[model samples]
Target: MHDASCRAGLARHGIMISLKRRIADRFHTSRLARSSVVVLLVMLLCLATWATDRRSLHLQLLTYAGSLGFIANSVPVVLLFFMVLVVSRRVIFTSLIVSALMGAVYRINAIKLETLQQPIAFSDVYFLRQVNASVIHLLSHYLSARIFLFAVVSLVILGGMYFWERPLLNLKRLSRIVSALLLALVAFGLYRGVSPARKLYDRNVLRIAPWAPAASELHAGLLGTLVYQAIESSTALREPVDNAAITRLARLEVPDAGAPSPVASQKPDIIVIQSESYFDPSTLAGIDDTSRLLPVLARARLAGSVGQMRVPTFGGGTLRTEFETLTSVPLAAFPKIEFPYLQIHDKTMPSLVRVLKTQGYLAYAVHPNDANFWNRERTFQSMGFDAFYSRKDFPADAPEDGWAIADSSFTEKMEQLLDRESRPVFIMGISMEGHGPYLENPVLDKAMRDSIPVPSTWPENAAKEYRNYAYHIHHADHELGRLWDYLERRKRPYILVFYGDHLPGFSKVYTAAGGFDDHQPASTQMVPWVMVSNLGLKMPGQPIYSWMTGGTILCSFAGQGNDYYAMIQKAQRHQAERRMASLDRETLEGIESLSRLYLRGEAMPGNVKESARQSFCAATGVTNP
Candidate 1:
């Protein structure tokens, strides 16, 4: 009886195994029938490209690719893959339709490509406006070859997908293994490439270039060479860089300075305003009537110290500029690396805020946007700011836009802060009203269409949109006027250093306005740095200082009597030496060498660091700390 019962159980187990096999086989057959090799190849190519180029293989890349892919080609590869695999046939078509619709919606609302080039936040509506503008401009300009390029690229992707999907899907078993191997090889290659490239171009080639090359250009050449070589060798992706090693290299020791000096009595309330998209349109002669766009700023130039400020970047990356201004550190040193805000949280920064705090000044950083957006809160706090005001602190009546609080509202808030602070304060206010999505604001739109004159360099084709940007500038001017009026009424001595973060990213507008000449090294990166004083300090007539970073401005204004001032003078002088010595090489190379040493926590070579220290002592009329 026991033997018969065991036999029955064994038979049931065999039946279950057969059923499972049948189900799997059917599933595989169906998949094999539908998949195309060409489609799979294209998808693999795209994935490979993204995997190699992006910093990580995380969800962020997927989301970014999904978002961009949907906009560029009306397809959501991830959603499509899931729908095809899991959903019933009846629902598959419906899913695709819905995905396409949603993609279109997102595409319309996203920020324009040109706008995205800047450091501005993304918005869907803003993107739609750009699409409309691009479409219109493309039609007007009628670049058939450009259009052909777009069409051909699209067709190739789609056609490849249609024909190759089956074979690609069928190869999933083998592909998985191949992908893993390739990814590893690619990562390793990247790591190897970065080090040698940094040493070669960053330390060697760029050091020799006659003109300053953009950081992006340098990075591109390095990445391109690596990719080309890797492909030629058919090697698997390599492992990524060791984060621990990189971090260790980045650490440095702070110099020993005894007790810091007392803050200057005449420090006056220091106010630094980073104006959004502020540029001297007058620089682009024969463009729109800049007089009409910025009448107040233009007129003020005549009465005050005014000239071009050579900034480090164009279009976006405002925080980098802020970093330069606050730290008196040159951006040219670490061309490819981002500002240290993300990387160095614990490092002590010898910034103006810290210098002021030592002297009993209440330091604050004010921005209309989210304080956490770029780790601004932590960065400012680390820099020794006593307080930070973000969107949360904004008044109930503040104006609204896609970004943070409007410039007008920000101005009002700043005025209140100016009055309320008990101690002589140092305030850094960042404006946002002049930010992008220039078409949606009623005030700006009206101004562009009617009052504000578009720059002449604006393509006859893209004039309307360019005019809108000008109108935005006009609005910024009005806000400045209000601030100036309030300052004029005050009895307290204060100094305001106002400048634009960078030129806006509308190449057509810049070219039309005559600010950009393709033949000439386009340097719209040059902004207007002006010092406005209620206490009657005289600034230079020609304020053009050779490509000085922003952080040096504070020391420049404080006069040569403070430790901070002396330090800057020293640094600048040392920089001059390096520059002079590197006359045969590229200035960027020397900057990188200095930067590497600084980041590695090594003492700057020779007397560079000490000279700056001594310069500070001399300027401030105080003994060395």
Candidate 2:
């Protein structure tokens, strides 16, 4: 028993020695190990700096080396982390794992921001919260190879970190605290001392490249760009509207007794359809099967007006156009508003619906999606619709092939509403059947898919997407015919205003099919708008339309005049672009000043301020008001 105990003691001592050696190696204060960790951090940071800009490797390397002084920027934060390492006496693996993970996230986001051509502005974080599959798909095209690239680089970085995990045993608490504080001061002080950062602020570099954020980011390093955006967030520079300018605009227009939403004399039944991402397929090149694209629209094209509708947002943000057409206010004039519904909650506006109500029409809105998307429920009420019909109100069996109500069913709903109405109806329908994620588009069946011919040179993905979009577009066109045919036979005279909200987000497919010019931005492309009227409703001046002009167009059919309608008529007569480049700064200032006054709680009507409803009713010769 004594001999067994002695052997056990010996084994225990041997295990203790081995454990001590392992701990000593991992937690040693070796000068070389400490220096290696510092070097690794420096290298990783330099790499991150280069990744922030999409520049050639040689130029990026030079930039990295040149900005070595900025290494001080991260040192204090890193030291604070290392101090925690000291307190816990954790293995160097702990420090390396944490730092490297942080570095990977930071660098990856920087790359994405650079690719987006926008800095991490204040709204960007907010946008993240709203991200859905569509947003991911939109970003995926730009980052085709980035995921693989990031994984490879991160693997290499972590591999190196794993080998260099070493602790700083002699790093005393006082010494660590002082070093961290001093390093923080040095970083801030040196950053402040630099003239480059100061110059970025002095010049307002961000404003110089308002459309191209990447240019500003390239000029200013990531940190500098961040600072600039932060400052701008807290204090956005708003162009002041001159009060004197408002009076000058008033002088420019003589009160016309006639113009309806800008000039309607007849109270015709009006139907406006805000089609989701619907466009003329023939507008793109190489669409062999466009024979089925817009048959009814082709026949109706010559009746009223047919041209492009220029919208503010692209791929998404449908409400921007909806608000513009409903109210004669240009979104470009309001820089601060993103989603107007969110901005103007519970606030009444001079909308087309409000105008129609005064004309003794039952104004109603129909959207075959959720009531709360983009907060349409509140916005529709504010716009003066009597009530809203959303997804919940749609038929339970509405979805035939996929989610949401089908366009065919939607047309059925419109017919039912009109039939059931006690008065002439002003129906505004926002269609969702054409909304996308074309990847999951219900296959038009194998037989139909086989009918469409794809270009040989086109990428597989583009071809597939176009085929799917074509299927939906076909359905939309067919349903449109049904609506038009039904309207043609109706006893009441009617006007059908049909327009696409915006071009669909098909990415490279748009260019691949030769539909859009690859050299230009997608937002610059226009969607087709056709007004088919049984009541002689027509746009008098410009063939093209903007959101702010929709109300004016509708009012013209009623022979009504309002402040906005009058302004729109002058713009159309003068063939003025929204840019107002033909006008002098003074004239433009006057125009904007008018917009500010009129848009701020001012609903459009007569030369004198009056209720929008009253002005609309009076224009229609109704003595009720």
Candidate 3:
């Protein structure tokens, strides 16, 4: 009886042991499943950072793998990748799409930034809010056949992942715990000085924007670089902030305000026109084309004064030069700041418009674009313009050039504005027609292509671009004639200021045409500026900085401008008549002082006051802005 009972117990114990084994097999991940996940991760890392630059092709993949590991050691980067996958429902399709976008932007920044002095920053994204055909015209020139290859490879990887992998419907609790612990380790690295994201960026990006732009993609990996940029941008320029600097500037003997009369008292029917990407391509040699790119401008130059306008940016960032021209503020003082409009938001920053308002002039700004672009509608008000006239205000029948309103149509709008004005007009016109991505043009572009000739010495791509650019600026030149004709017919005393914002960013073509070096130096991008005024103005014959352009205009006839412009004019050493780039160390100190006071709302020294209105800060407190 005892032996039978023992046998029953042994059988029950064996059955229990078999059940435990089945449970363990169900939970355990197979070697094939583990390998598949590893493969997917490796593929993603490769595709996200596959660089195509010939210079970078050498050992680029190996470099990217190393860089990815280093970047992933940053807590934020790891968190961002995980969150992206989570947001996409862990579907291979959506996740890969995200990876593809990040990769494409990486290449675009690497290629486009070659001609640019800086890498892709948050400010560049802000500019895209108002992209036009000009933007396309410019972007297409930078693209190569490699981009298609990237797309194909990306698609193939995505397809393979989609077919080979099952939905990550569930992860074991232990697997999730491992992920959390890994992330925690990365975060801990900050204290250990291993993955200090901000420190790494500040040390690298300055050298990168100018020298090794390809590194922006390869060094940190795409998403990793972007995450670091976000952190760096938020905290930048804090290093330069000094209360003592503002105090020292306030103490510097204020240069006798050149504008004894001010932006108001001498408001000489000011007409400032910034033609889009306006430069005389004919100035460059080897282009066999005989005619000047802008005949009207050339004729006007003969009669008036001609000089180069040294803008702060290249190819894009019109607002930078525009802001400089308007406010007489040297970008030099804020060298690290990319876009001031984005940076100085919420502040009623002083401008020529604000200063001109103090005088009896009614300032009206006109642009053939949506008023909201570059946040201009609100920003203009902050600049103190009495009114802004945008596309909505233009004549409905105004023709389009490429993607923008024709320059002639823009002048027509200016004429209409001048026609209705009862008060002295401080009218500023910004033309969109010559604005680029000059690859596509209006219906009229085709008709004029034959009329436009190219240089035999120029590359085929350059010849094509020059043709498109020449055709558009030709109309811009014609419209310049129209504006002057309209002004002359009105018989009004006008101070017409026409200047190019910057050279078009035609990198390869410009280099091939011998117009520029591969290094893309700042001096090679000089643009033309012509001032023709009935006010009997004394203009500079040589080059002047764009920031100083407005001050020279305002102070020309009357030698009168407000405290801010007057102060800037005082800083000019050689071209005292203009706001030249003469901000010597002493001048910079003064400007820096004033910049902090105005843009930052910091107070002037107790003993000193820079202007009648002590503050340029609006009632709104600046935070994110």
Candidate 4:
């Protein structure tokens, strides 16, 4: 009886063990179970790629890892891996679709390379145009080939994971855990290294723009903070200001009363030409003297005051310069992503046109570009211009370049307007012949090139290109001569101040011509500001190199420096006064500190008056109030 009972117990135990083994094997072999493992692996890989590629993700992971121990890091990674598995397909599809759309949109808008370098804001109407194109492009470009490739690769990875899961799952999990733990330990070490300098970040670090979508906001915010901290903590990076330099700057004399007392008595007809890419190429080093790119300007300089005018920016975005010149406003601490013209279409501006109009002057603006470019038509109206003539309004005979109508033709049109208009016209002509794509224009003659002298700084190799630029300058000069001849006969008091909007971006010629060394900061911001008139209304003093922006020109000319001009001038005066009062070290330190803080978006505690501060905030769209 006992032997029979023992045999039964043994058989039952063996059967139970075999049953458990069979159940485990069946679950592993099933299609549903296999699919789940494949999906999990694919999701993990995708998560890893995202974590490594995105700046925000890397920053967050590093921060969190430093705070937590190895085990803690592993827990989040594992949890995220599983979470991604649930939404993997949706996330991948969304990303692909968005990328495709973006590519398509960029292509359709004929978005130039220069436009892409700057920030893009929501206020830009061009954004809507691009979006429309992007949708169409995505359907044509991304939905088929790109989508299929991604899907196939994903499936292959899933298949591989399914086949290998039973043997490799435990090892894969353990390896990931170990790697995360090590990374956490490393992050903690880095935190310790940077702990001592954390305060510097709080004091001096500049914040990046926060415009990413909600899904990315938290990540971008944290990442930005970390980057700021890292930069602040670096001992190698020197602050822009030092104590000794500030003292010297303060002692510098206030501009002597050389410029004529602002001409308050007479309101002359204003002919403001915001010439396109107007920097004299001859100014660059190594250009041949024979090219004579700016001979006419050189001649004019002798007759009038010609010197460097400091502009706010370089390369593209001419409208910002226009805004500065017209409104007497400084460049915003943080530049707007799009042209302010488009952003503030309906808003009023205190422009030269408006001011002249108040004096009963007929104000007009002429541009050889598309009316829609930068939304200038609406902006001009808002700025109080009585009329705006763009490409659409110009005659069909006007010569076309890649960007706009030729400067020569534009000038001719201006001449016609000057002759026809009954009122004292305040005409603003924007040139386009010298606009980029810097290729030579067939309309330009060799004699035209030879007539304009190249600057001493231009490189010899760049003579031809400089000559091309010179041709436009000579043509402009010839046109100006004609206008002056007319003004001479009419004997009307007219003021024409012409300056380059900004320097050209062509690196090879510009850098060499500007006499900038490889290590020296580029002086592309320095442009020609010439105040020329046929009437001998002499400015009071010798030529002065005042570091002034576009907007200051009109106000300075008008003998009134209210609003933005007063604020900037006052700030400069204060800095000068402080330098004179303080020790050299203290002065330098103060200036440096002011510049640093100003660049970083920090308010200058007590320096700026409340009204000026409000104006600054209003112009820049900063919510100070």
| lDDT (C-alpha, whole model) for all candidates | 0.51, 0.60, 0.62, 0.50
Query: What root-mean-square deviation over C-alphas does model 4 reach?
Result: 14.0
Q: Is candidate 2 or candidate 4 better by TM-score?
A: 2
TM-score of each: 0.60, 0.70, 0.75, 0.56
Candidate achieving the largest lDDT:
3
lDDT tens digits, residue span 1-625, model 4: 9999999999999999999889868755576775675566544544433333233233443332222122221332334343333333233333333333333333322233232222222333343453433234322421346656765776676555545434413335556566556656544444334553243223223223332222222232322233333332332213454434433443433432223334334555678777877766444445444224455567667775565555665656688778766755444322332355654434665565665576577988898766666777778887888888987788888775424466667877888888897677788788777665343334445565555455555566455555565566556555565665666676556667777877764534554455543334443346776665534443312221222332234434443433333344433434334443212443334434444444333454433333232211101111111
TM-score of 2: 0.70
What C-alpha lDDT does candidate 2 achieve relative to the native structure? 0.60
User: Taking the tens digit of each residue's C-alpha lDDT, what string does model 1 give over 573-602?
Assistant: 433443432222233344344444444445
lDDT of 3 by residue, 229-336 (tens): 555455444536455654555444433433222333334578899888888775565554334656787787677567777788788788888888887766756654
Off by over 4 Å in 3: 1-60, 63-77, 87-98, 114-118, 127-165, 169-225, 236-267, 288-291, 442-447, 516-524, 574-586, 603-625
In candidate 3, how many Å is residue 486 off?
Answer: 2.5
Model 4 / residue 64 / CA error / Å: 14
Give RMSD (Å) of candidate 2 vs. truth.
7.9
Ranking by TM-score: 3, 2, 1, 4
- The 10-residue segment with the lowest total lDDT in model 1: 616-625
TM-score of 4: 0.56
Question: How should the candidates be ordered by lDDT, best one leading?
Answer: 3, 2, 1, 4
